[model samples]
Target chain A: MLQVFPDLKGRYGDFGGKYVPETLMGPLQELEEALDQAMADPAFLEEYHHVLKEYAGRPTSLSYADKLTGHLGGAKIYLKREDLNHTGAHKLNNAIGQALLAKRMGKEKIIAETGAGQHGVASATVAAKFGLQCIVFMGEEDIRRQELNVFRMKLLGAEVVSVSSGNGTLKDATNEAIRYWVANCEDHFYLIGSVVGPHPYPRMVRDFQRIIGDESKRQFLEVEKELPDRIFACVGGGSNAMGIFYPFLGDTSELIGVEAAGKGMDTPEHAATLSKGTPGVIHGSMTYLMQDENGQITEPYSISAGLDYPGIGPEHAHLFQTKQVRYEAITDKEALDALKLLTQMEGIIPAIESAHALAQAFKEAPQMSQNETILINLSGRGDKDMATLMEHFQEEV
Target chain B: MLTKTSFQGKLTKTEDLFIPFIVAGDPSPELTIQFALRLQEEGADVLELGVPYSDPLADGPTIQRAAQRALKSGMSLRKAIELVPKLREHGLEIPVVIFTYYNPVLQIGHEEFFQLLGENGVEGLLIPDLPFEESEEIRNRSEEKGIEFISLVAPNSDQRIKQIAEHAKGFLYCVSSLGVTGERKEMSAEALAFIEKVRQYSQVPVAVGFGISTNDHVQLVRNHADGVIIGSKIIRLIEAEIENIEKGRMDEALKHFTKEIRALVQ
Candidate 1:
């Protein structure tokens, strides 16, 4: 009887409404209906879980960071290994779910927008598996920064469209993808990569990604016999964090969302939406967005291309407003240091985006007692970020 | 107070109401006023002025470029709202509709936004992003302020067309196509059927927009709709005449283009 999120109007408190064009309203409504029916259908749920388990590798391990924990010399740290999932990140969870929903709806084409190419790769992977046509809109700047993942998307037989508008980042890619969907909504299902966008998308993405937390809850309980004291995840559009945080919403665990504080929050550069942004609508949702006084969205910066978005998810905005989640900013330098530390101490090279969570955990882990544990969602592997890492650590690597 | 009757008065016995849309502050704020006056002089039935936004999801490349130009010229919601008063002061008597995305209106609270539009002599408002479901509060406030809150009915909006049309003020903005605002080669048969369907429930005047350009488009749209709104093509015309306007020709090219369309629709 108690609903955790998105009431009938698709709102999480005052945030998250369907603020899209009139054309998209029908498609979104159709999607909402189909998703509701699919979620309730047992066979559909079975098929979704089956694909997630047999194909995408669900129940990713929760590994103890013994060396890193020892180096920190305080709280024991554990990693939820979403980085080990097929396609090397947590993005596949939502992609697979949406693709399945698309197939059930009898749609044969899928469209998506990606900033770091992780979502694009995941969408492309699912499309390939399902034998559907896939088109990915990526910012030109993101395409240049994330070349390997771009290639990966293409290799998986998805058309990668280079968007060159409005700073050519995630926001622009999303705009392009939405535009493409508006024109071609008859046969295409828009596979949104994050827990942002209009109503059902944020809720649906959270639903799909919640498996991370569900598995983590089970795995942690089986291993440690209790919940961790804290959970940390990096927030771009807040998909991975929302995925890992949803199942623990009612739990006593302290949820911390780490945003990319590029350069610093004080400077003009950063993607710390909850920390610095004001509530405004962007990409079909009213959320905390980095915008000017005139309500024009401002460009956000981060060394991690995946974490370079200017808006936080509407649910995260609600969470921040309600004090359900504490958000912190991690600078590029801090995230890089944490990435290097994890690679050296634990032999796990995390994606730069996921390293943001590690950065926050490293800071907090040192302050607590060793008996207290902190769980960090390692949302992706570092292979896609190798070029960025090499560029940053040119002499060292 | 301005109402749908005020707009109906502009349409002659033999003419389809011609509504022209332009991004406010496209070349400059000064040029925006000049264009508004020129459009009225060129027999525009109604004027739709767009307040530029950073993310206009419902707009296509041409309009997007125009918005970028307007933003580059320092256009903001406040400035765009201020332009309405200036148009009234300039003795432009046509009903001016503020065409914008929803965020700016939400940023400035609904009461204040409608009040601002009312104070500035703005007769109507069109938010492409604000669908019928999310428009109640704003629509109510706009009605209280006596500003016609225009509703858009898209091709994809199936049964909701009746609901939207029942409450549509000023006019029902019938989106001629499925995508963002742009010029198209030909109007789809589905769009013609969509307009016919919307007409079944539309008590207010039905004005079709999006991809409506050229004499052929105007001629085709006039057969089924009460009015035709032109946006991207007008922006393109302004863009084409930008060099001339900068050289002190004073939007002669745009004025000529508007005059030509006025003649075609008539």
Candidate 2:
């Protein structure tokens, strides 16, 4: 069988390349080689799966959302319960994989950048488990908003560094992380949190997280005796969406990625990268970026901190360009409404990030026939998003 | 007027080249031109003008701040490249290399960008983010335009330094340390050894850049490399003189800073 992506040059159809500084070139090459070797090694794969099974709770449930389906009153809906994973998010899948790779490479330290602090907490948790020193770069604003996750990261023995530059958000935090990685490439492994950044990272992260789609595909077939008609997931830097979508590529099932439309896309406040962004380079890879005409990156706004990024993963950009995946934007209000509805009906309070997917699914599910099924990747739990939810639903709370 | 020479030609004439970096359009573009001339007058052999970018992954806090200021002042890559013609028109004749990240150049089409640089009298280019592996297209097009595409080699480059040094044009940029561009208290001991390793591979002149700020840095790098490139400290100086430059006393502040470094390099 032919490989789907990441050609010899690490290009995902001219979108992904090693567009990093000279200091990181050798290290990235080393990592690419190591990843290739590790993937082919049966021992490495066995260890990775063993750890996932025993430590991170592999093969998370795929629950049929009967009430959500009834409420929509159109199509059957199923939730791939990545929220049940360790660290309460799908982020740990990639983090644990990378931490294992770091250990195999004899790297003793690992670093990561986080937006809502889910990835940070996940990285810290894996680091603590693997006995590697962890450092997480988070924006000052995010640290303020996700204080509980920050404290959780600290409690897991990871150092949290607050980035104050740019909009003091995810984009700046990523920049600082890359800067730190370039400087300290000799001793540290940058366990990037998303399916973004330079070449091998996007490929490697997707490979690690593709277990979600693989398991979902097997589970959905076992229950429905067929693939779901549609799959919905939110896109920040697109790790979770890519995870669930990669295995289903080329299949008859439709893939839809929902982006956060903050207040509204009309108000210039949103993180709808695929919907609104143009092809430009940011972080490291050439992808669809939220930048001005002069190529300066613009600050993205989303009530969901995890979705507040100005760029999407290059593979997602390629997928969007090729029309393999349908991209849509859901307003903050729509996501919140979906969040409340899901909580009331199913007691599944999702992270605001995943609520974007829920919101989109809620809209589309009602239009389909009852026999048609829609699978939504519930990417994370809502515990970290309680503060934002409480503020938005103060009257209800 | 300072003679317009290729970067390669300049290396033969000077024992030690002192290149000062300034972010174009910092505070304002007019001050940038003034500072460029001041550096030329203060014995800068080549000028590295940074085109402000929103995300400068290779830059530390000081250069990052300068880029932010420049970007806030409306400095786009087009505007920064347009400054090169302005420098030529004003009789500033040093070989000006526009130091930029690759995204801006990619945004402006590689052919059009190199065409603009050549047309604007730019002689060399330095993109810190475009490493040897990803630089083939841009580097080839730049050389075809008669513009030198500079390559950087880091201390941790290991055996890859040979491949980089062999294809390096104009001069090889030797990163003094592993980190982003910033002033260091002292140069790392591996810097000289790295430059020496680079010397074994290519005949091109080697200019050490990151963390080279003060006279002590200049003195240390001057003995091992053909050039010393100061970035963050000069940006820091320009930042300090922002108030003075705004009041039209730009020369007093800029001249003082450049002259001190110029005297040490000389």
Candidate 3:
């Protein structure tokens, strides 16, 4: 009913635009037009809804983390179990939608870049399901850290290219992916993993993933009879945060975004952009990013692979600028601590990325009144991160 | 020092020369000064001192790798600007144009950036991210500071091309391809066509960029445009062949890369 992410010129405040090269301009314009037509096309909507519910596993549960919340001393913490989504994490919600849009556009190939490899795994999985050739660009470092995902992508019949340049992180990988897509722009649909990138991407991904908030809103009303006192999620490229944050953009609920502060905020190592950054553009859109003068991309570190990017999604930039949502940094120590506590107390070994939100809950829940409710989007289960976490623990011991 | 009018005066001539690009702080920010001095020593007509962004969406692997090394060595926009003073202190009076994206400029306030650029003896600014339509603020602010805000001319609508040509200061960067900046063996013919269009209407010199890699590419672009801009290829030459650019390897690498292009220019 409400126009999805309606703002000026497809911008989320001061951020978001097709700040791309001329090669992709025509196709991007065409895609924007096609999406407009598809949005109005009932057949397209019907097919999209059908695939979302049946294939990707929609309507994920919003289970309350009562025991964990009780231990934190105050507010009721609810978990929007997006980790239950097939292929893991909230990336699938938009990947399926974009892959379907690719189908409508008669595009044959799918390309994407991944950080923690969750988005790559999800995108490659959807591309396989759609019967399309998939190409994934991952940083060389990510390939080593997320070796299993690389192998999984290969097993799924997708071509995985390791980008070795430019800090070899998510942003660099995304740049390489865009370059690949630009050179091969004729028929490939770039399935951007999150709510970053230029114009239509941030807007489109937010629309598809808005189902998280829509469904959660209804479920909460049905269950608790009131909206959440606060909403929480991890911000990498920040899709899950936006998906869950978009519907409640104007709502009274306080939205909190947790960024990865690897080691600590002061070190050159952390990826806490919002906490220690000024306004700058990275990738395509103008947003807050950790960069130096002369414009060299800084190395962003995080214990959680997903929240390791130096720049956040444009909407988060806008929300942060407008003070609509509060953003804070959660250290690697805090996230790891939260991960273990959630696993021990709730039997939920949440992804380190999601552990950021859990850490936020641990800090904020203590100050919240008992009657107040906090919603934490448990973006993914921690299975993929087990090897890395174990290796980290073994090294520390 | 060339006045904006004097630079514009040079652009009015029909003859084309050479405009070479070098990634500032490629090996290290300290070494970048040496490279700038070396390029000047090597008879470079003009220099595009590329200020490396962390995420250079327009660059290929070669330039990206160079940027990584530079950033790792603590190269900042402030440091790049400071290089102007270092270069001047070293007595190199070549017009140093800061080749960077708009984000860093925006991050360091426009007035301050222009003032620092002017104070440090920077003559021009070539930012790929700042389209001409959104450049009025920068242009107005940079006017008295004697900073020339360079504009890019894409192979697009004649109207937009004309508008860019009219507004462009220093030189009109005529991109050789419609995509991001990179090294390519062959270039789009449409780029030549675009250059011809810009040459016809431009009040400034037309310099071809994006894929003008080899000497042959420069020769080809030279036939139509006023100047040739080569970046990724030169960066690749330095990156691939040498381990360090500072120990005088940068000049040796650039000598080989530039000799190939200069031969064609001659």
Candidate 4:
């Protein structure tokens, strides 16, 4: 219910703060100040919106899932179609905003990190459009898994550097990206992909992404004439979830964040940070982190490459602690099953990351009455996930 | 137990201070104590002992490899802090500073961590990630245990250098370059003027670190700053001798290590 949180030091209930090296302090402060000034300027906001509407296709449709609703025989389901946005995912929303800021700040080079490479592709697209050099860091393992997305980033003229440390996943890529930023922050801008990292990052990323919920709210109100009973969004560093859930926080809708259960939460192989993680620091912020008793970060596993992270966003940590939002875990099989169901039933292929939230909605939709409504943020298109899906369904086909 | 008062006060103020860093258990904690003694004998005024962590963000590739080796030997913040008493017993009496990332300390809990420092002979504490803004509680907690909490000022910390240096306890840890800890061919030429700015604000001694790789870097920084803290170079030197130390050739490694550090500092 709290609208204004994350006090001046960027502490979202003592969760988010700048835990970076001394070298990054001044730069972070400058970023915060610059972002604040930019957000306050009407010209900046106008330009950001102009790019979003004309280029990336803003007001992404909120379509009624009639077949899904009839299949469930309970709640009427609606999909917030972020998957239709430019770059084929919601990642472009934040990238466009941050890239504009980079150009405004006179930064010529942009550095980014990715897991499924959606964010990398988005950053690369914006950098190419804006005529700035782009460098993207991705885990070696991810590069192998998300080959199409990796190639797409390169096709956009971004250099894709493979990181091989710490399970060679998003966490490792983020570490390499931050290290590079620390070294070259004087000339480069770090275009973060999610609602994670230190201070102004989580805040600015959330603001840039809040457009999802804003558009959904308007569209839903126009159609249903009332807010949905429940909102579902997958939590991978919580960018899409934060984007869709933030505008509805003050509303009566119940917010649910679904995390990747990987094999299962019972097993060590899962990226269920909000469910199993404890309070600790990772990637320059104090949040719910999957780490051992000795404070060593443990590797997380998930079928969804985007969701395979050891830590959740600091805002999600705050929301979880405050009990304003409920957090749940969906296993890999359930996500796959839901993806298949959505593809077959509606001819809409959702990204495996978004399928986690889809699975959650499917499970709970049967419980609510038909008059009640459920809105799911279909965060990305599943085209990039074909490689991963084929590997899973090869024998079946 | 070694009496704890101040590395800030006890170390020689007349000459430029030489500080060498090594992971607590690269092979074993026993070797770390021996290494500490060797560094002390080789004119190390302060010993900055590190704890192996899974993700060390500020460290470059060289120290990361050393940390991985140390972690394989089960080195932790508790083990790193507890090693101080062993060093004292082995007749290695110098100002011991625990250099670690914040998560390990968070795992130990702040109260227990400070108590451990008090119980051991740790005179100084440095968490590179805890910048000036987020370190008030830690600074106060360290002061409660009489451990001087070191503050770091980087080349980019334009106006904040004064605010940070004003509260600095033992010595201001001046970053010699604009990046993570590594061995670089050339030091940032602006580092000289940066140290001068820090000196103007800091009441305590200024120790420059992060890529003090070559002897030229050491000499250049030594003339301008009160102390020179060497991390990646020492890790690199010890890494070269890891095979010899693992083979039970401690004396040979110690002699080689001392000669190597002696060249840089002297």
Best by TM-score: 4
lDDT of 1: 0.88
Query: Candidate 3 lDDT, tens digit per residue, B1-266?
Result: 21234442333343465676777777766666666666666656677888777666666767777876776677777788888788778767667788887777777888788778877777888776655544577888767776778777665434677777777777777766533245554445666566667877777677778765556666667666777777776676556545534455655765664464445445
lDDT by residue (B1-266, candidate 2, tens digit) is 11233663543443477788899998788888888887888778889999999999999999889988888888999999999888878878788888998878877888788878877878889998887878888878887787888888888789899999888777778877523245554445566567778978865677888776557667777876777888887887778887877688866877776766566566
How many residue pairs clash in all the candidates, one count each? Answer: 0, 0, 7, 0
User: Where does model 2 sit among the CAPRI classes?
Assistant: medium
Candidates 1 onward: DockQ, in order = 0.81, 0.74, 0.34, 0.82
For model 2, residues A1-397, the per-residue Cα lDDT tens digits are 5346888878888688878888888899899999999999999999989988989888999999998799789999999999999989999999989999999999999989999899999999999998999999999989988899999999999999999998789999999999999888888999999999998999999999999999999999999999999999999999999999999999999999999999998989999998998887888898998988787889999999999999999999989988999999999999999999999999999998999999999999999999999999999999888777888899986
Candidate 3: residue A75 lDDT (0-100): 93
What are the lDDT figures for the candidates, one per model?
Answer: 0.88, 0.87, 0.78, 0.90
lDDT of 1 by residue, B126-241 (tens): 89899988988888888777787888888878978889988887777888653223565445677777877888887777888887656777777777778888898788877888
- Candidate 4 per-residue lDDT, tens place, A219-335, comes to 999999999999999998999999999999978999999999999989999999999999999999999999998999999999998899999899999999999899999999999
| DockQ (model 3, Cα) | 0.34
* Per-residue error (Å), model 2, residue A320: 0.9
Which parts of model 4 have CA positions greater than 4 angstroms off?
A1-3, A395-397, B1-5, B12-14, B178-189
Mind giving the per-residue lDDT tens digits that candidate 1 earns over A131-227? 9999999999999888888889999999999999999999999999999999899999999999999999999999999999999999999988999
Give the winner by lDDT: 4
Off by over 4 Å in 3: A1-10, A17-28, A66-73, A266-269, A292-295, A366-370, A389-397, B1-12, B25-44, B68-76, B82-95, B143-146, B156-166, B177-192, B196-201, B236-261
- iRMS, all models: 0.8, 1.0, 3.0, 0.7
- Give me the displacement of residue B194 in model 3, in angstroms: 3.9
DockQ: which candidate is best?
A: 4
TM-score of each: 0.96, 0.95, 0.87, 0.97
List candidate 1 stretches off by more than 4 Å: A1-3, B1-4, B7-15, B178-189, B251-255, B258-266
